[model samples]
Target: MVLADLGRKLTTALRSLGNSPVINEDVLKKCLMDVQRALLEADVNIKLVKQLTDGVKKQIDLDNIGTGLNKRRVIQTAVYKELCRICDPGVKPWKPTKGRSSVIMFVGLQGSGKTTSCIKLAYHYQKKGWKTAVVCADTFRAGAYDQVKQNCTKARIPFYGSLTEPDPAAIAYDGVEIFKKEKFDIIIVDTSGRHKQEDSLFEEMLQVNNAVEPDNIIFVMDASIGQACESQAKAFKDQVDVGSVIITKLDSHAKGGGALSAIAATQSPIVFIGTGEHIDELEPFETTKFIRKLLNMGDIEGLIDKVNQLKLEDNEDLKKNLQKGRFTLRDMYEQFQNILKMGPFNQIMGMIPGFNDFMNKGHEQESTKRLRKLMCIMDSMSEEELDSPEGHKLFKNNDDGSRRLRRVARGSGSSPKEVFELIDQYQKFAQMVKKMGGMGLFKNGDLSKNMNMQQMNQINGHMAKMMDPRVLQQMGGMDGLKKMMQQFNQSDGSGRPGRGGMGGLGALGGLNFK
Candidate 1:
């Protein structure tokens, strides 16, 4: 079972009790059995599965905590906690010191994606204002140097490697020395891997480690390797002090559950997970957030981080325009840019409860393509059109709507109807932003600030109109939305859902707000 399947199965097992009037030992036993079956099939170790089930049982003390507690929610929460516990190693991963050069080393088996991960990590640090560099010391692989060089060059990151040097240790030492002298804060050394565990491989890894004396040694593991992750991790840990682990290739049909349990066995923190082949696919892993996403529960904090990141990319002008209730085609284009920067759409949607199922239905790519097409249509428009107060007004003026639309369609190679559709979208967006701006609640998307009952109803009504019927039904229509908002308000003490959806971005329906 893949992790997604595992989550579904475990959650399904609890569905039996979700509506049950009474819970007894027999029902608990059955639920545990179902959970055990799912975990075992997901390639999770037998011992770990047994431990998790036992923990859940112990935690759900029926008589001790009685009917006063919602038994259904308690039991489900118990399972959720135990599942998250299995993924956590109960220790913090090593971190690089700011303003100081931190020598880090990457190690893994052949084809485990160590080189790609090195560049990914380097790019991650590079984006965060660190002077990061990569050292390709994997002389054993046939085209390792070229591959690393190619990726680093594409990312515009400084890289050090040698085509003539046969000794990886010497290259690693010299690379580290040069980067240190140049005051690079993060120097990542990509080491060699073997087809399988061997004395020669370990010896080579040991040589590179001794030469560089890295501050952190990260062991990369292929998630698809499943049950073998434990042995491979142990093999590397025996040789070096593996402080962090990065699991790659989990976006396949691999039984990722095993890797989680096995990595836990290695007593190292999982610092990141590779979700795809793209360089931006690598994401810093948070145990609770990861489990929440896996179980189709939202990762609110992660969503906030993504929004914050986009805001840091010079959104002051957009914010100012939104404050003045001025949303134009240019604002729409800016929103398109923000959508792209928010990482994958499916990943973003998965952070909202009930959205993972929506994504799994295959709308992720379709929506992205549509957004891209709309952007292209906007790009073909003239500067006057993009900055125009009303998109439809440009076509509706004395110049004639059809002729103006034809010009745009001709330039963009899109049908006139497609251009009309884009304008229609822009119109709806402008209307919403105008309303938000009128109420003076447009301060950085603080949706609930100074909001009265009528204003809440207005916001809720617009959300209902924009939301798909299916999504509305899942959220229990307006009643459910009210409940969700109430819960959010209670927990956060912010009077309402701050950021609501899209981090603190609030309403992008007008390409407005932060």
Candidate 2:
């Protein structure tokens, strides 16, 4: 299944669980366990995972014992509450100004995608009608100037950087002056990234902050850093008041649990997530949806946002074709085009609950290759053939079907059997589209109602079972295996209906991982 499809399925499952009138402790425990396992597989921090799960468990227990609620309702409430607590707690949302420019400084370790994120952020703000400009103060890196310049060019945003300047503070101060004079609504400062312990780099950041006086300090961290995120967050917080975080390389991280929780522990909200290396791949952070996605509940809001951003409305004919069960090769090709917008197949699928675990196992590269090949074959078809397969002249008066098969095979660069397989796959998908009442599959309410939550839970449960230590080692002793297991267990036990494990450990209040 596609990543969006998997996410849709997970969302459907969670909604089903949420809508349940009764809450069973056993069921809640099992669901929480599944969520825990999913988060662990997503590369979230183990300790943070524990804190999140414990919070949910505590809430569940309180609801069950104090309120005497149903199993499903209690589980839903606990899931919502705990996810919000871990992701945001007391974190405030960023409200963009209408009349004034907002300065946001990007910081991170070297190669953490800070420079790229700056351009992406610029594009994001530009899309919102903000006059955006990028300032490159990364004089420390060898090719930083060229990198930021190239990105600014692609984004069509103004950029200010100098190769000869040794003083980053002077560049920052001048950049702000230039932006102000140009009347730009936003100025994004791309600072030089360094390791957490680089005292000199930290001092430079302080100097830049003093010069720029940015409204928001964004720490860009790699999602794949896993357990090390705690220390990284602490280090950055000590050096500067990091107002928010942007977790990059999310597509590569199988366990993304630590990025948000670690920063949240430091009292910083995650403002954006970098799902891919592309300039437009950054997304605003939403706590509830993110938690649901982690637990394989699916992110309906995310899917809708993607559809809206992709301008799916322009493809009215494709919608009609899908609804009429006439999903021809042309329609299939168009769907592929849309899929590309969501990033790689594996990365997209990772956003869905159960599939995330599989994606982390390095299956994304393989999936991308297969999808590319499939698309290539579909692309070879003529417009006429794609529009009306039965009326095509290529297959006229061919009783034995050999000539027709050979023609399609040659045109699509595939064996006759492979061509037939593609046809069969398309036909099956067409049937599914018809069964789903056509284009209603894109509607949040209808799509959620049609999803099989039981199947999703079963799949997640099976994957979790397969990920058990004995099974994992038997398959192949994976790197970062222990951390993954710990995160999984924590998510699984997150929402049990009663003061579940809350009092066992003291609140992790004011505990700095650095």
**Which structure among the candidates has the greatest lDDT?**
1
Model 2 TM-score on a 0 to 1 scale? 0.68
lDDT of 2 by residue, 1-514 (tens): 2223323333444555665466566656666666666556655566766876787777766343655445565666676676667678477856568678778888898988999999999998898778999999999999999998887897799999898889999999899889988888889999999887789999999999999999989988886677778788889888888888888876655556567557654688888888777787787777776666655544433433444455554566755554453556666666666666655554454443344445542555655565566677766666776786232334344664556667777876789777666565555444444444443433421122233544334323333333335334432343333333223223313232211011100000000000
Question: What TM-score number comes out for model 1?
Answer: 0.92
| Candidate 2 global lDDT | 0.63
Put down candidate 1 lDDT per residue, 130-212, tens digits, no spaces. Answer: 99999999999899999988999999999999999999999999999999999999999999986344888788888999999
All candidates' lDDT scores?
0.77, 0.63
Q: What is the TM-score of each candidate against the true structure?
A: 0.92, 0.68
RMSD of each: 3.2, 12.4
Error of 1 at 446 (Å): 5.0
Per-residue lDDT, model 2, residue 18, is: 66
